[model samples]
Target: ASAFYPAALGQTTLEQWHDLFASNAQAPFFLSQHLAPLLKANQGCIINIIDALAEQANPDFIPYSMAKTALRTLTTALAKALAPEVRVNGISPGAMLWPDGEHQLTEQQKQKILQQIPLQRVGTEWDIARTLYFLVEEAPYITGQDIAVDGGRSLNSVQLHAP
Candidate 1:
């Protein structure tokens, strides 16, 4: 894709990873490769959970971010292309969970994040699941957009410190 977000992907060359992520010319792309059939059958919607860090800021996971951003864009494009039949949308989650195989988090680190959230707490998996359920089963008219479940982290600017 571009330069600034250059990061080593596992063990593969950065260029190779970039090609795999940003500009794959293969058929079905990704979700369509598998879900095209299922979605058509069930007339279901696509809820792609694009990470908040995707197009945001991060020193680590830069390559992953680039890939997710492409996925997010695809969600919008797919929604429009499949409109009046299939629905597609994205959810951008911010600081939802620590990465797997977690190490201990410092109290300061935890407080720093909590303060940024207007809700003043971290999000849980249930929060996401319920939201999806609503947009899918409840909101029949919704599509082609993202509902940010960030607890207002995107608006954060003021510094927070643990007492």
Candidate 2:
């Protein structure tokens, strides 16, 4: 499933927020639940593509953050609910794709974001894909985990007060 949804507060209505949550979070949970039998029989895995904002608050994108956080919670819940039959995990991506058109970032904004990432770069889609492959094919003993494929962006630390 894709994590495409509308963001922005105030401009986004309550109904829009609900729709975003339903599509981003609820759909995955229900789909997984509906496919539980098939997954259990085949020992399958569910990998959710959440957002890095799920782990942190983004004042500018409250709805999107909430939806992703819900998905993250659902991933852990399903992992336990599905148990040994099916593995459930999540990948939270950070700055993998540039926003198009009006949402595009300025060079300064882009540099600021990159500087926050310890790796000083954005991740590739392939990074997330490889992690998914590992969770499914190699991580037999692993479940109920959310891997951050974020090029260390999530580890960026803020100094509330400078040293």
TM-score: model 1 vs. ground truth = 0.74
Candidate 2's residue-wise lDDT over 53-145, tens digit each? 887777777888888889999999999999999999998888886777877889999999999888888888788889988998999999999
- Candidate 1 residues 1-163, lDDT tens each? 2222335446557566656464522222464647777786788887877766775756555566767777778888888877777888888777776534345567798898888889988788988898888878988898888878888887764368999
Q: What are the per-model C-alpha RMSD values against the true structure?
A: 6.9, 3.0
Clashes of each: 0, 0
Q: What is the TM-score of each candidate against the true structure?
A: 0.74, 0.90
lDDT (0 to 1) per candidate: 0.70, 0.85
Candidate 1 ranges beyond 4 A from true positions: 1-28, 98-103, 157-163
Clashing pairs in 2: none
Q: Which ten residues in a row have the lowest lDDT in candidate 1?
A: 20-29
